[model samples]
Target chain A: GESVGLHLPTLSVQEGDNSIINCAYSNSASDYFIWYKQESGKGPQFIIDIRSNMDKRQGQRVTVLLNKTVKHLSLQIAATQPGDSAVYFCAENAGSQGNLIFGKGTKLSVKP
Target chain B: GAGVSQSPSNKVTEKGKDVELRCDPISGHTALYWYRQSLGQGLEFLIYFQGNSAPDKSGLPSDRFSAERTGGSVSTLTIQRTQQEDSAVYLCASSQVGGIQPQHFGDGTRLSIL
Candidate 1:
């Protein structure tokens, strides 16, 4: 019954603005989490990741914040660009094998 | 170095036919995973392979779905008597190790069953 779910199905933002996508996971045992970006025809591309021990992790222009207390996760993209328009997903590493449980993606659209 | 590679960018077959999908993982990578993505949906874990360990097939949707890894590198997912419901994109990913590692993915093979 444990599931990883997203708070938003779609997010539209101006190209110069920042965007925030949210995810909530029910499995507290999951220690690792990852964010991926998927373009229209491409596979999911690794963006950023965070472990339970850490509350936040930063990548080139993205930041992943984890709130273990509420089992919530968020991805922040600064200066969103047209190239950054894609479907974003959050996945939790579950079980001993570390199989990822992915949330329904949030389609991010950046308008110029 | 190249990332994970999957063959036959697209596959079209009949409902009663069988199909084999291939995945060539990155060199020296010991972990491989298969996932299915229906249109506008999230990735569904199908199977995983880690080094010489037996593969974890827990996510396989049904007996019609099966996979195998040869010599710990290339992998093949076979679907027997495919159905219309089997139409989806099959994605392959690989990592240096299994647990908590960032996985690189291939463009995936789009399977269309008629």
Candidate 2:
């Protein structure tokens, strides 16, 4: 079955350092990918998204890179702060079907 | 000015009981989705509604789970004879249109079946 999976389940990063979360997707048909930040006891919030046509997309201090050839996706946070600590999930929209498959999130812990 | 909203922020019921969860999508939004998330797990697509068309129920886990969107606005998810394994957080999200667009999510309803 096609699925989106993450390389790490948990990551600990020091404040002001850069953080990278990786995701691997099996669905080659996916044309759009999105990154979401979910805090404890809250719903997933959209952070940034990139289309298959673009290799990278930037928003605020976050950037999403898509490597279609390798079927890999990544989210990079610059100058990571304590507020940026949350479970980050990568989701892929295979098509216009509105079905988004999400990867098992990476829990990011930023230490001050 | 408002985001998606779900009712019964928390629900606790015994096994074999039935439960209904409601989701109120943002006004004028035509697409709504339901997803389930277990502890320490990722989001699981449950069902999706696009306008007044038939919903894509392929993601529904089993016959015990069902959902419906009325008038292209609100939606309700029903779980029958729920079991302990059904415990999880049910999230509802709405988008201006279906597919490729960013979705605004509700706080979600946490269901605990004991």
Candidate 3:
């Protein structure tokens, strides 16, 4: 079965430092990927997304790198802040209807 | 106010009872999705709806779980004969279009089977 998974369960970083979370997916046909941030008691919020055609995509303070050859994906956050402390999830669109398969999240803790 | 909406922020019900969760996608969104999140775990895809097409219920956990989308807008996920293991957060999300679009999510309904 096709699945998406994270490399780490938790990542702790100091404020003003950079953070990188990694994910591995098993589906070769998946063409779309997304990164979401979920705070305590909140839904997963969309952070950034990248299509298979692009190797990298950048948002305001975040970047998503997709390596289809190795089926690896990563989310990079610059100058991590307390507000950025949350569970980060990586998802791949595995179906034609746009259903997503999400990886077990990586809890990001930014220490001030 | 423009994001997806779900009703009953939390629900506590005894085992064997049936409960319904609601989701209202963003206006004009063509795609809607439901997912479940167990405590400290990741999201699991439950179902998907796009436009007027038939829903994809491939991810539904069991026969006790079912869903319906009315008029391509509001959706209801019904769980019958709920079990203790059904306790989780049910999340709803919508995308402006179907393929490759970023989905916006709503605060989920926390269903606790006591």
Candidate 4:
């Protein structure tokens, strides 16, 4: 079965530092990717997204880098803050499918 | 003015009991979705609706799970003869379009089958 997985289950970072979360997807046909942040007791919120045509996309204080060669994707957060502590998940949109397949999220904890 | 809303934020029922979860998507949004998340598990796609047309229920885990959207607004997911394995957070999300659009989610209903 095709699946999306993460490199780490949890990541800890000091406030004001940088954080990077990695994900690996097995389905090569997946063309769209998105990153979502989920706080405790809340629904997952959209953070950023990137299409297969683009290798990298940047948002406020966040960046998503895609490497089609190795089927790897990464989300980088600059100047991480305490509020950035949450679970991050990477989802893939394969072909014309309306559903997004999610990865086992990475829990990010920021220490002040 | 609302993003997405789900009913009965938490539910507890015994095995073999039937449960119904409701979802009210944003006004004017045509696409709605239902997903499940278990403890320490990722989001599991369950069903999707596009307007009042036929829904794509391929993601549903089993024949015991079913969902319906009414008037292209409110949706309901029903689980029959729920088992202990059915314990999970039932999340509802809505997007402006079906594909390539960011999905807005609700807090979800946490269902526990004892």
- Name model 3 segments beyond 4 Å from true: none
Q: Which stretches of candidate 4 lie over 4 Å from their true place?
A: none
What lDDT score is found at residue B77 in candidate 4?
A: 96
Clashing pairs in 4: none
DockQ of 2: 0.82
lDDT of 4 by residue, B17-57 (tens): 99999999999889999999999888999988898664578
State each model's CA lDDT, in order.
0.93, 0.93, 0.94, 0.93
Q: What would the DockQ be for model 4?
A: 0.76
The most accurate candidate by DockQ is 3
Q: Better model by TM-score, 1 or 4?
A: 1
True contacts kept of each: 0.71, 0.78, 0.78, 0.69
TM-score of each model, in listed order: 0.98, 0.97, 0.97, 0.97
Report the C-alpha lDDT of model 3 over B1-52, residue by residue, as the tens digit. 6889999999999999999999999999989999999999999999888865
lDDT of 1 by residue, A1-112 (tens): 8799999999999999999999999999899999999998899999999999999999999999999999999999999999999999999987767679999999999999
Which should have the higher DockQ, number 2 or number 4? 2
Higher-scoring candidate on lDDT, 1 or 4: 1
Report the Cα lDDT for residue A31, model 1: 94
| Per-model DockQ against the true two-chain complex | 0.81, 0.82, 0.85, 0.76
